[model samples]
Target: MPIAVYVLGLGIFTQGTSEFMLSGLLPDIAHDLGVSIPDAGLLISAFAIGMVVGAPLLAGATLNWPRRTALAALQSVFIAAHVVGALAPGYGVLFVTRVVSALAYAGFWGVAVAAAVVLVPAEAKAKAVAVVASGLTLATIIGVPAGTLLSQSSGWRTAFWGVAALTLVSLLCSLFAIPGGKVSTDETHTVCAELRAMARPQLWLSYAVTAFAFGAVIVTFSYLATLLTDVTDLSEGWVPALLALFGAGGLIGMAIGGKVAAAYPIRTLVLGAGTLVVASGLLALTAESTAATVVLVFVLGLAGYVTNPVLQSRVFALAPGAPTLVGATNTSAFNVGNALAPALGGMVISAGFGYASVAWVGAALGAVAVPGALWAGHLQYRGPRTGGVVAQGAASQEDPAAARARA
Candidate 1:
């Protein structure tokens, strides 16, 4: 991995931490601001909605600009999000800020992945995506945990301030570390071109893989704080620690996911999905044991995250013609999963199912992804020249060896 990769990784951490930490602190914000917890939950939803809206909106709007310039500009938006979040006067202000800041969130990750892949050897593309995504995983481990602690000990506003500072540092790091380049020349993606990529049966299968995989994870995570406080019989004080453990698992998974994808991307996802099958059972079973619960949370987190790098790489591989939009929209797919899981999980919980039911819901969600991975595996086995294997656009090499061979 290059130094620039590490720089992007760190920047991602700050951005991710800022984005996710709000969930853990939702109760605190609600109480202080005199709103219901459900209302506070909107802060998280608002951000996702922004990402869903922004990914395509920003990517299409910025379609013709330099990647580096677009990335730097997104960081500026990140800082602005922090400002609004930190200085938010009331719930309405906070809600608006979350959405606005989220616009940066969706666009940054989308553009970052496309640019990050080329920074390393072609074989390392998944690793590079994992490196950038590690920022997000680290946010779960370090960023969200620390921010929660800050919100508890100081003020929630202080947590926003800290994130603002983090984003500022991310901005500086991106400017200093990333080498300058044009990145791509094929900038002609018609509405039909994008739809054409989507038309690929394998691409839709890949989208299903991402949507379900991420949905399962978010279903578990979105309600994690409640599970700890309500079912596990832990004190409010211990929730952040448990959440940290969950995130640490994500960090570990993200760190290794790239290398794993490099050696056997399809197999890794196959194996990862199977773990979710077991993890969901274990989480439901172990909801009463602190130690057992801890281990299960770690396992579930790892299983959920291990598939991320491979999925992103697969989307780009399937749709390299419009890599920017493809990457952004794939991110939208993942977020769509995240968005839906919580809604479903919330429904189960509201219907008087136990908090542990989220795990079961997650398992069912994870199962949907299996066939998609199997389909992609089948395609990989069949070879690209076969009837179903259409390169959605010019190939952006997922296999550096394959790219080099063609070169």
Candidate 2:
């Protein structure tokens, strides 16, 4: 692993903190701005919308720039946006700032992931991505809770200020650490060529695997606090601790996934999603038991995150030429899953299914992804083709010995 990869992870950590910390500060924001809690919650939706729209748009717009320059520019914009958020006069200003910050974050993620892939050997691509993604897991475990605590002790604006400061540091690190050069092959990729690459069925299947697998995980996870308090009879204070435990499990899962995905991408997806189904089903059945709930939460996190590296790596494998655009769109897919799953889970709970029912919803989604994963694997085995000649670009990059060993 290169030092630059870890720097990218730090950049992601700053972004992740800003993204997830909003959940913890919404109440304070609502109170301060004289808005309803639901209105304040819309800040999250604004960020998600920005991500879905900005990922591809910004990525394509900057497709011609050097990777490091794009990353630096995006992070700079993100940091400035957070500073504006920290100093916003009212809810509307904050909302606009959140969307702007998210656009920068989305653009940064696309460029960062594509840059990480370019920085490492093909055999290490998944592991490199996992390293970057661990920053998010770390944020869940530490940053969000810490920001919540800060908001409680000081003010919500203070949390934004802290995030802005951290982002500035991350931007500095990126400027100093990330190599400054165009990806040699990527320079030739015209917008039309990238669009053509994005149109592949295999790539769409890869996106499906990303959306479904992640949506399945979020279905249960989105309502976990309710399940813990209402069903398992845990006190409200225990929720944060248990959530941290879940994140700890995710960190472990991501580390393991990184190692395995380089060799066993298909198996990583299948087994990870399979475990998620089982874990979610058991969670639904045993929600009344505190011990069982605790155990299952960690299992759910583990199973859920283990699929991330596989999904990310698959998108790159499927569209090797359009990695920046495809990777950005894959990030959009994850956000789509994040937005859709919770709404579906909330509907189930509203229908008197109880909080545990979300797990069953998750199980069904995971089941749907099983065949999707297999379909992606089939495409990978078929290999990339152009006209009659097999395009060996991505396939040839893998270590033959590693592939055979996995076989």
Candidate 3:
């Protein structure tokens, strides 16, 4: 497992860059392909749509496959996708390339998360999950920035080439590193049974909680460059640095979330959501000041990412029956929220409210999420205390117990 996590993380990091680097490359992509910025934006939407639609459907279809096989196959498809994107003849072909590349996000990341849990002893599940999940954070921290620079220096298409190369490395690593084991939950339950897990009201509740929290972050960050240069009045070079700072905070948050969550995941869930609400307000107001803006942006990233590990941990506690599907669907919810936030934030920005307005939109939506967190809290109180008990058992071991609780 030493290299397995790194392998999986690298694979996911490549996928993450392919999926998210578009925002940074949008202008170049638009102008190069003879399309409008809005048209280029659709590429982002297409990738996200692929993820939201693909996670469960792909999981169900590949339900019986071994974990390593499934992951390798998905990443191979992603590599082909980036290659196609690099060599695309026109917008249609490139768009399809994006959709194809995006297909890897949900299934691979989901399987990877489940794999991380199973790869270690029962005590390290949360830590393992965090390590795997860091791929997305690292994409933001390292991949996106590096990809942005690559796009600027060579061309946006070159970034795809880079990601494709990374995927090849990941493929080799997956071949060597992943130990044979069960990654899919559908072996015990039918795909129908797994799909039925979504029918439970708690699943929808989990979706809402995740949807809003992540949505809040994306809405503002989607237009973050606009905010920094236009609103915050920072120079162009400062944008990536600021974005990286946010990612750094996310790195810290992801780690802290795992550590603190063992004691009271339920409380952490609400606290994490609430932090978004307050942080959004602070960011919206302070965005005009360079110093305050930078500090708040870092804090925002920290608080925003803290919810991810906590939310994943909560979903596992609630839906132990199908943790793989649960984890997969939760990832879908994150993108669903991502798909939503910017569109809504766009309407405000379009109305001439200014760049910082997106932050307020994020704030309002985040405020709405707090109540959902509270409702989840009540559900925890009334319903299964099993997760709480397990979390308590986990608390004693912290990371050690996390690895044990994978079952």
Candidate 4:
């Protein structure tokens, strides 16, 4: 809804491309750095680990800084890290650069989310979030493919160079577009206060729902190609196009959720999470049916992504005391889901279950989120006060109209 939101989304596209494009470049990187493929894969792990650590750390450290300043500083660091990574002489240097770049990316995400919500009216908060998060979907659809093409035409180093150049454009757009101000003028957002806000049981419940619901999506997605080829009997050539279709589904879901989640957060979560369970279960059951599998895969992406904006908006609503820290913690929860789901799916496959079983595993993971969302909704309705239904911190910032709408 705001220019800054789209600018931040553009920045996220660059970072997400950097995050995922490496999957395609692993062979080139391994060959160039004289390492094994698995060893080159560790670079992705390093970035995930960095995001988990840096989101809260950087958000806390820069909590008091101006939002524009923090964003600019983080993007600058990200671009610098990419440049260094492109020129890296050895695997070790490239690994370190990847971690550094992820830290910047995570920090930027934490700050950008907090800033995005406050930039719009209360009714449009989820829309703002969807706009920003759409960048990641776009990255999956457009940026990663373009990076792979670039790497094939030039070299893997050229991909990194391209990201650095793109990030410079995003950085300039962010600095020029985002308004200058701290996320909150409230003086109570001290470190101690932020820590106290983190102690809310309801907030943690929301995080669990985020992790489980989002993780369910990743479980199936992480193994999608294998499932498509082995179960659906498609060839390797169709993988990219089908994956783009999934990304398109995500964009459609986000656009729809953005329009509705502000008025129906709990409904959005329940329905979205329910769709994940159904889609995954159906996918598991119908894996051998080519048409069924294709349709279910698209449903999986739609169901998975529709919950994102609702999950994010709920966190800000539940923990208004420390938007930066809360946002960062939620970001970490997302990465946690990302990390754990793939491992769980891998374990399921290792246990002699076929790739189709991973979809069942995803269904189980999505099932876990349903009650969590219900529990959160129960807390929201039956808790202490009108505005601060879930936590004392939320009362200070919760929109009365939204509170009444929820009522």
lDDT of each: 0.76, 0.79, 0.76, 0.80
Query: How many residue pairs clash in model 1?
Result: 1
Best by TM-score: 3
lDDT for each residue of candidate 2 in 160-229, tens digit (9 for 90 to 100): 9898888889888888898987633455676678788877776787788888898888767666765777
TM-score, ranked from best to worst: 3, 1, 2, 4
RMSD in Å for model 2: 3.8
Could you give candidate 3's per-residue lDDT for residues 1-407 as a string of tens digits?
Answer: 46787778887787887777776777678779998655666677778777887787777666677878888899889888888899998899998877777667678877887777777776677677777888888988888878777887898889989999988888888988897666754466566666665465666787888889888777777777667877889876777788788889888888888777776665666777788778888888888899988988888788888877877766765566676777788888888877767677667766778778888988887887788877765544432333322433323223433433331
What number of clashing residue pairs does each candidate have, in the order they appear? 1, 0, 12, 0
Residue 92 Cα positional deviation in candidate 4, in Å, after optimal superposition: 5.4
After superposition on all C-alphas, the RMSD of every candidate to the true structure, in Å, is 4.0, 3.8, 4.3, 3.9
TM-score for all predictions? 0.88, 0.85, 0.89, 0.84
- In model 4, what are the clashing residue pairs, if there are any? none
The C-alpha local distance difference test score for the whole of candidate 3 amounts to: 0.76
Could you say which candidate leads in lDDT?
Answer: 4
lDDT string, candidate 1, 215-264, tens digits: 77777787777788778888878878988888877767766676666557
Location of the lowest summed lDDT over 10 successive residues in candidate 4: 385-394
Encode model 4's per-residue lDDT on 279-370: one tens digit a residue.
99999999999899889878987888888877877777677677778989888888777667766776777777887898998999999999
